[model samples]
Structures are given as C-alpha cells and as structure tokens.
Target: LRLVNMRFECVGAIDLLEFNICNNVEILNCDFAPADNDVVSAISTVNSSWLTIRNCRFSSPATDNGFDYCLYAAGGSNKNLHCALIENNIFDGMDGDGTAIHIEALCTASQTVIRNNLIMIRGAGIGIDDDSDQAMVIENKIFHNGGTPLDVNASLSLMNMLSDDGTVTWSPTIAGLSA
Candidate 1:
C-alpha cells in the first residue's frame, strides 16, 4: 500500500486495502471515511495479481453507512489471473444505501483502469459480476443515486462512461441550465 496524505473515519468491513494471493500492489494518496461494514465481499483476491489504486478517496461511514465493496476481487476464473489498475479514486459518501465498487464473481481484469473517479451515490460506481473481462470504466463522474448508477451483471461486455449529471437534474420542462 502506497497510501499518501491520509484520512479515515468510522471504518469497518474494511478493504481500504487488500491484495489477496498477491502481486504488484499499490494504493496511493488515500482517504477513507465513515465505514460500517456490510460484507458480501470487500476486496477479495483468493489468487491476486498486479493491483493498483491511485489517488484514493472512498468515503461515508461515520454513522450511517456500510461497505459492500470499496474495492474487491476474488478467485481467478481460470486463465490470466487478476490484473488491476484503479486510478484517480474519489468514491464519495458510501452508505450501503449505495454499494461501492465490486469486481468479483471470478476474476480476469486486463489493463483495468477505472479513471477519473467520483461515484456520487449510495450503492454503485462499479461492479463486474461473474467471469469478468477486459475492464475499464473511463472518465467517471457518476451521479445522484440512491442506487443504480451501475450494476454490471458481468459478461464479457460491460462498458461505462457514466455521468449521472453530478447533481443539477430535475427538468420539469425547461428553464434550468442556470437560467
């Protein structure tokens, strides 16, 4: 773990760090907030490999939230093991009212790079279920979500450039872009 700066509060069910089975691991510039632990999986790597999380910031747990995943991985599916590189992280205010990043159900992440992150919701910013494949959710800026910003049921074809508007969305029929 190459965590820099640093700030973590009310943590539980933790995976602020986990490089299971293990390989090249590095989580940099860290900050985790308000965690309570809601386990199903939290950074698993029964047979891990090259993992990297940069500029980290996973939040929300002090009193009203729990983690399903702030980062996760699991048993290798069969072939070229788990290869990860999560970049520029800032998954804010996770409360399990919104799950946060989970890539498991049998791993195979190649050139994985979830870029420019800021998942703002309660339950999902990333999730790749069973038999995972080439992963890369680019330029992330996910939005207002009590849920469902993303929930990949996992096949070899999940793609996201998700931008849920970042917050000024309520068009009851025109007159707001900053009228």
Candidate 2:
C-alpha cells in the first residue's frame, strides 16, 4: 500500500497506519498529527519488508508526559525482514518519553536505512534496539530535543563503517557517547 500526500489526524493513542506481513509499502509526503495522546504513534510496521517512509511530517501533542512514539517498526526475533528506509522526513512537537523512531530489538533489519531526516523534538529522538547489521544512519539533523538524540540498545550490534576503498573508518555513537 502507498500513502502519499495525505493527512491523518488522531484523537487518541492509535496508529495512523499499521501493517503486518506486507511488503513494498511506501508512505511519502504525508502529514500525521495526533492530538493529546499520551501513548500513540503515526506509523507501526511489524514483520514487513521493503517499506519506505520518506518526505513525511509528524506532529504530536506538546504537553504529553508519557510514552508517545512517532514511528515504530519491528521484525521480531527471527528477523526475516529484508529492508526498510526512513529518509527526508520531519518530526516536530513530540513531547514524551518515547523516541521519534523506535526500532525494536526483535527486528533483524537486514538493510535498514535512516538518513537525511530533520528531527525537532521535545522528547527523545531515535532508538534502535536490534542488531541491524546493514543499518545505515547517515546525515540526520536532530536538535531541540529534551531527551537524548540517539540510543542503540544492542551494544555489540553497532558496526564500524569503512569506505569501499578501505580508507575511511568510523563508528557510531549513542547519544554523543563513544560506542
């Protein structure tokens, strides 16, 4: 399914788009806003692959004090998922404890890419709980957040990057802390 240039508003803690066992789904140029929800999210995908969420906007309550997530994607323990991408999106007015993007531990995302995103938040930024070996988080601008910017729970899962020519090498950091 493809959701493009659409608007979705939620009055409660319900996901705007939730899917499972599906593939090749794309959500682009969409607007998702939730009103006064202490717990909710805009997108939630489970056990799916080839999912792309790009050029989208998300807005949540500014007074929420509980768990409120913007996007939640999981693949479970088995990790059969193929690929997922979140890029060129904007997140704003998030006011809660949860992260803007939460990648669950069970998800073994083979090729998960989160890049070129602007995250302006009043809460946490992003969280990756799984060992996404092929995960690439590059060039994301996260600021004005009340909580940490990034969190990777799978300590050993964080990989070192080396250029194809093997000249450049770098490692990921968790909330500005060396990994």
Candidate 3:
C-alpha cells in the first residue's frame, strides 16, 4: 500500500509517473501540473493482480491529455482485466481530448469497483468498451462533458451505477449506460 499528495511536489506543480505497476496505491489532493499542457505523465500501465486509485485531482486544458485511458489496462478490457478499485477521485478542468476522464476497459476487469468519483471533462467521462462485463460504478458525480457520463458500448451482466445519494437513472441517448 502507498499514498501521495501535496507533500510530494510544489503546490499546483505538474508531475508524471509512468511504469508497469502492481500492489495497492492511492493518490489524493494531487494537482497534476503543467497547468493545461495536455500531456499526462501521471499514468500507470500494469500487469498487477490488483490496482486502486482514490481521491486524486487532475487538471489539464490542452489538446493532448490531462489523462490517458489506454495505459491503465495492458490486458484488454473489463472482461479480461483483474481487480481494480477507483474511488473518490476528481478529473476536471480539462479543455482538450484526454485519453479518458475515468476508466476504459475493453476486457471487463472482474470485481472492478468505481465509487464516489467526480469527473468534469471536455469529452468522455467513464467509458467501458469492447466486450466488457460485471463492474460497479457507485456514488460518482459527472457533469459538463463533450460526451456522456458513463459510456459502455459492449455487454455486461451485473454492472451497477449508483449516485452519491444512492439513486440512478438509465438514458436512451447512450447505448448501454445507466445513471
């Protein structure tokens, strides 16, 4: 287990973390820097049995990325990826096209749980694409994006999305996303 926050760098500073990782890690109150550079250095590519991201804050306003979607899962998508937990993180202030605002799994990522995250993006909130299955997204607040809140274009069996207040709604605008 590990944790990172304001103490790691100057306030409003930008940093990047890259590598293949394992084990449990937490990021909180970390204002990803370069202040609108769009280049996301703080990313993880992993073969780990499990991964967890919590209480982090990412801000970018460039065309490249304040976030990257493809790096999180080297395996494939939600269906093939293993356990991952993302909780209470904030991805906002992005003006460009990021990799993803939240999570994108082509595999399924069994036992995957995303809870209480706040995502404000120029495009895309949480996207689970390509034959994914069985994920729980609960208590997340998403708003003001060029795209939908939760976008799942594949298949799922027991995927659940709950608002912070414990309520949800399904929409017809998106193919297979609810609440």
Best by lDDT: 2
lDDT tens per residue, model 1, 1-179: 35567665544554544544666767678776554544333344555567776887766544256455666566444532356677777776555453556655456666666566666665433322223545655545566544566544233223344444444432121344342
Estimate the overall C-alpha local distance difference test score of candidate 1.
Answer: 0.54
> Residue-pair clashes per candidate, as listed?
9, 1, 14
Query: Candidate 3 residues 81-177, lDDT tens each?
Result: 3577777776664434443333334544567776676665455434322224355655555554345556543243222332322344432224555
Please give the distance, in angstroms, between residue 12's alpha carbon in candidate 2 and its true position after superposition: 1.2
- Report the error of model 3 at residue 43, Å: 2.1
TM-score of 3: 0.62
Alpha-carbon shift of residue 129 in model 3 (angstroms): 5.7
lDDT of 1 at 58: 69
**Sort by lDDT, best first: what order?**
2, 1, 3
Give the distance in Å from residue 142's predicted Cα in candidate 2 to where it truly belongs: 0.7
Candidate 2 vs candidate 3: the TM-score winner is 2
TM-score of each: 0.26, 0.74, 0.62
Runs off by more than 4 Å, candidate 2: 65-67, 79-81, 123-134, 153-179
Candidate with more favorable, higher lDDT: 2 or 3? 2
Error of 3 at 69 (Å): 4.1
Ten-residue stretch with the least lDDT total in model 3: 7-16
